[model samples]
Target: MNYWLFKSEPDAYSLSDLKNDNNSTGRWDGIRNYQARNLLRDEVKVGDLVLFYHSSCKNIGVAGTAKVVSAPYPDPLQFNPESKYYDPKSSPDKPRWVCLDIQYQQECIKFVPLPLIKATKELDEMILVKRGRLSIQPVSPNEWNIIMKLGKLVC
Candidate 1:
């Protein structure tokens, strides 16, 4: 299955929040960017693995692993006028955004911070290290292995 990195602000929805969700699973919603939305709708699939990265925080890095439990579906938040992610241009028949359901897998014993990732030559080509702003990004198997090793988590 394809591997991916899913970034979230710890203050908004941290890995801990996912772990604490009912059944340790929840819908991954609120993706607004076109590129990120496309990835979620097209590339991401159920059973794919995800590196849960905590961004816009003091320790930005892959904090845990999660497994996609559902296929891409229209983001319900987009249809809700009260949601911050709501899109006036989108409708039930034509959705502009998509999301997936992911189940918490395992939290890292030690978070692999950005500095550590940047120091590793093998991870030089990672989109995250390249300052990519997309919330959902594909990850190479090698990169996934390296990050898992660094985070002290079983791959």
Candidate 2:
């Protein structure tokens, strides 16, 4: 299965919120960037591994692991006028956005902070660094392994 990293502001939708959901899942929405949009709509698949990253705050880090438990589907928020993510030009026949359900696996003992990961020479080539400000990015197998190990799940 493919691997990915998804970031969300803790204040808006924290890891706990995802965990608290009935099925330990939630629809990832509000992505507008073309690249991030493609990842959510096309690349992500059920069973794909994900690093749930907390972004835009002091707790910027990979808090836990999760799995994409469902196939991509149109984000309902994109069709709701009340939602900030609503797109006026989108139609039911032609969805402009998609989202996936993420099921929490387990929280890492110590979240691997962005700063720490950046400081590591091994992660220099990671998409999180090379892509710069991307809210969602692909994580290579090697990089995922290193990170999972760093999170002390090396076993």
Candidate 3:
């Protein structure tokens, strides 16, 4: 299964929020970027692993784990005019956005703080480095392996 990373603002939706959801699952929506939307709608599949990264906050890092639980579909928010993520260009007949549902798995117990990632000599070319602000990104196989070796998760 393909591996991926998704970033969310802690104040907007934290790992705890996912854990507390009914069934600990929720749709990942409001993606405005076509690239990110494509990843969710066309590539990500159920059982795929996801790194829940917390961005735009202190201690930005991988906060927990989650797995895709549902098939991709047009993001409802894109059709809702009231939503900040609503897109006027997206028509129901031709959807311009997509989303997925991810089920919470486990927490990392300790933040892998962004600073640490930057300091890691091997992760210099990680997508997170080039696309610092993309809400969703594909993690390279090498990058994933390096992160797994960080040993920062609480035992």
Candidate 4:
């Protein structure tokens, strides 16, 4: 399975919010960027693991883990005019955006902070350390293992 890092603002949709969702599963939606949208639509799949990173918050870091529980599907909000994510140019026949579902796995006990990740020599090549502006990113297996260890969670 693929390994990915999904960034979410804690204030908007934190790992805690995901854990508290019904069945601890929630739709990962509102991805507007074409690059991020393409990843969700074409690459991400069911059973893939996710590093739930809390961004734009006081504690910016990989907070926990999640598992992709569904295949990519057209984001329902895109069709709703009232939704901020709605796209006037998109329709049911031609979707311009996609999203998936992920289930909460385990919260990190140690809370691997961003500074800690950036300082680690082994994580020097991590996309997070290099170019982390993307809301979604790919994580190498080695990077994943190290981060999991740092988070004090079972690999």
| Highest lDDT scorer | 4
The TM-score-based order of candidates, best leading, equals 4, 1, 2, 3
Q: What is the lDDT of residue 100 in candidate 4?
A: 91
Model 2 regions lying over 4 Å from their true place: none
Whole-model Cα lDDT of every candidate shown, in order = 0.94, 0.86, 0.83, 0.96
Write the residue-wise lDDT of candidate 1 on 36-85 in tens digits.
98899889988999999999999898999999999899999999999999
Give each model's clash number.
0, 0, 0, 0
* Pairs with backbone N, CA or C atoms under 3 Å apart (clashes), candidate 2: none
- Cα error, residue 125 of model 3, in Å, equals 2.1
- Judging by lDDT, tell me the better candidate of 3 and 4: 4
**TM-score of model 1 vs. true structure:** 0.97
TM-score against truth, every candidate: 0.97, 0.95, 0.90, 0.98
Using TM-score as the measure, the top candidate is 4
lDDT value, candidate 3, whole model:
0.83
> What TM-score would candidate 2 get against the native?
0.95
